[model samples]
Target: METEDDVPLHLKSLAAFLIRHHSDQLRSITLSPDPKLHYPLYIDFAELMNEDPPLAHLVFSHPIDYLRFFDDAALWAHKIVFDKLKFEKAVEKIFIHVRINISGSPLECPETFPSIGHVRVKHHGILLTLKGTVIRSGATKMYEGERTYMCRKCKHMFPVYPELETRNSIVLPPSCPSQRSKPCEGTNFHYVENTIICHDYQEIKIQESTQVLGVGVIPRSTLVILKDDLVDIVKAGDDVIVTGILTAKWSPDLRDVRCDLDPVLIANHVRRTNELKSDIDLPDDVIMQFKQFWLEFKDTPLKGRNAVLRGICPQVFGLFTVKLAVALTLIGGVQHVDASGTKVRGESHLLLVGDPGTGKSQFLKFAAKLSNRSVITTGLGSTSAGLTVTAVKDGGEWMLEAGALVLADGGLCCIDEFDSMREHDRATIHEAMEQQTISVAKAGLVTTLSTKTVVFGATNPKGHYDPDQSLSVNTTLSGPLLSRFDIVLVLLDTKNPEWDAVVSSHILAEGEPGKEKDEHLAHIWPLAMLRRYIHFVKGYFRPVLTKEAEKVISSYYQLQRRSATQNAARTTVRMLESLIRLAQAHARLMFRNEVTRLDAITAILCIESSMTTSAIVDSVGNALHSNFTENPDQEYAKQERLILEKLKSFEEFPDIISME
Candidate 1:
């Protein structure tokens, strides 16, 4: 008889029954006196719990064995207590996540195992226990009230319930009502109509409650990748479930796991799982609002706000970076907002530039799971017109299928193998990036679609971006496309041994000791909330620049552009405009209705710094320096005329000129 006081509230109900059932087995157990017993036993227990049948049965075979195991377990118990205290202390020092990972094979299977068991981890010797189960191999993805197929050949169907036998599928309704909402249909039978179709060798169907069992043949496509199989497998259209610690800085959106799977993993998962044959439904308002935000930034002050925004999100590059930077500049400096009651748009871009194992593809997988908005990753190699802009078709009036960009509007669009992208196909993005809209003119279906998205692109630099080729000429990207981005961040796996250690340690910490905690994506979330806040402010406030702010901006740009060439100077002007917008945005962040001198000065410093960097680079930088130093503008024109005149004179008097 277990006393109520001896049991925790959560475990009290089951303790009495469990003790009664295991009394015979419990009586055979004993504790060993060996000092080293706990450490080895703890390892053994962890291994056992990780397996299916488990090693707990060994404890019940004899008293000596039980005693030995208990002694070992004691040391582990103490370690857990010590580790918990250390974890608490660390948490107070900083709010960052700590992680660890350990590895071991499944526990040995034991005969006559109990229905339930406990798994515990002890750090520095204090034990923390958790209840878990070793999932049986034959288990299927099935749930109550779901429908089972009687036979694919005969098209037989039946409801899933306690009475149904030989169940092999996990019940996955179209959506979870508790988390989302259940589809409202006439009968429980209707719930399974749109449920995922699995193709396996054998089929099971309900004949009549207790008599329900296997039927005939199954579909060839029935072997959709299971959740457990996701680590190594990637098939198109399959819905995959993955869980991992979120890392916000590595990708535009937060990534769910540390695994190195690519965006194709999710793409394949969706392709295999969903049979809808149509595009996922996306709200139009979200699309419109994203475009509006992009356009609004054109007039917003940018200088300091751009720096602040980029400082906040360092991973993205190009048009994606520019758009967000512009948006943030407007919101923080100008106190601007979009038509939708949201702060400047909260979006991200991903630039994957390297060979395999560079985390280009894996980054996409992580972002998909971490973002609040939908994640759509497409292949530059396999993607078609239907993958980007709206494509036209038959008598259905060329219904628009929201491609990755369309769906990812107001969110993220990750593109893999970006260098492999077809030139014509890549051109589709030019309009989208600059105009914030995708214009389609294919199959007589000319229409404009919203592609206001943060494009995360991955590509391998040609021959590792030839260091000898000069920074401006060697870039694999075309000048026009490169120019679209506000910043171009370079990622390299340096030869630093310390970097390797840090990366390895970071991955390892995810699963060990007192490191297991929910990975917080607060950085990304705060930006989102800020966007909403900006929207509120814009709806209520209209900010303007003061004379001092305007004059300071004017004088700053005049001084900065003195050395820049004609075209390069134009960029400076644009930079100044961006700075002004940013200053206005900072004023907004400070809860002001007008740009202040402080905001203008802050914006100016950041803008001037970026201008300096851009102006010093090869192509734009040379052009900028030439405008002032070499007088190349007039000198080059005269030099070209002189060359032409000399060539003509030489052609007319070749004999006399040679004699002289």
Candidate 2:
């Protein structure tokens, strides 16, 4: 054992600092009886800076040296409890590793390089952090970190270490340097049994987020190494922030292949960002404003909601139903379990069958922006394998790599040019849409990955005017696939003179200085405000149906089943769930957890707009051209009240609702 005087002055100070700040944590590890239960102690770097700035800087500037000191000091801090056991004996099996936590946002932390791409030659051999998505992950295996060998003749132990900050094999001393009254020049050495410092190790590849890169610029990816407690914590498609030492490893040496050094991060701490997607910081002031705004319109909930809805795609004038549907789709519904132990998905899929130049892509882009995490790709640009999951060989090992749906597990995936996709590719999304999971059994690597993503698809019709045919015939989409979408709105180029004049004036008015296209947008929410609100509503409220709401949905569903004609594929048991989900979403949008009859009626109207061929909604004429009215609440009340009365007396009629 090294005496107190033998320990370096700086390391002794570090150990003293550990004892002063984390005596209780150190005491727990020292007092633990089972060696197999060895756990690393987490040290926040912020506290270290407050205690000793020089030491904190030293830990980052020279992590390889300070990290070894951390392991050694952990045992030295508890001489009272650990004096009974030999230092070497105690350290071999139960050494406590110190994982330095940078604290705060990893992206903004001081010790980290700006990003994965910003890492350069100057950043190597130091502590740093990186934030990216894991596109590929390898299987866990045992890694020999350090090895010990004993001289055959002298029986003296000699430690062999690998290259600095690398995974290269350890090189032993050619001759023993031990002095036993004479120089022991033994050429052969005996390997010590059970003297290897091994731990669980895994390799993963991380690609920088596409959101951070410009268009046409491919996202950069780098290799990362996880050890000990860090292994197996992250899988493909997970967004993670890893703190580690920046290092390089030599690629496999081969006759034909050139040897190259690839940069890798040997992870110390890994934090997943999947659950943190909706963790937007909502200020108390904003929350108060939300409460006050809702209170102001207690008698007019729809009006208050319309003010926020207009913010969705303010550039595109009108289309109230489409905006409302977009809001519900983004807010989503409460995912719950039924009595049969089956999990019902809360994700609502929306399909926009529209003509060119009708702002379909604009809605898709705006929806993607509202989501905290989203992937926007065209159907022709992606395939079934790319949309789901695939097993790829990375470093000679077959491992699962996440695709688009898996990558957007907790967010949105917008597919434009939907009709350009081949039929074979479209057929592969059945399980992903309905079950919310992507199962891959390729390459003997069978696994099921979650795809809890909201699919927002926008496709043009096969040709022109086909209102007489079903959506399947018009768009060439299958019945089963059409049923998965909760709402399918059509945007036609009617070429009406009045509509064209209104749209042209709206576009031209934006160029003028004083003229605003629509006065309703004066109170519309901004992108940041809308994002926070969507995250808040999705995370805060879980609405359930009231008796009246339940009755309304059930009655409408029963009537649709009885008089099923056109759009027959759209009306099924799944439609009932869709109605409930949309109603629940509307209730949340209304700032309440209890769905009301009005919410149910609104859900029915949205369903009607998707199911029928009418150019306008029930009361509103030509929904595409409908603008904000003077009294939206009154308008909403009159239309929904009529449906409420009709639904109440639906039992006696031959058909209260029909698909004709």
Per-residue alpha-carbon lDDT of model 2 for 541-567, expressed as tens digits?
989888877877888888778666877
Clashing pairs in 2: none
User: Highest TM-score, which number?
Assistant: 2
Candidate 1, position 231, lDDT: 22
State the RMSD for candidate 2: 4.2
Candidate lDDT values, in order:
0.37, 0.81
Question: What does the lDDT read for residue 24 in candidate 1?
Answer: 31
Question: What's model 2's lDDT at 648?
Answer: 54
The count of backbone overlaps in candidate 1 is 80
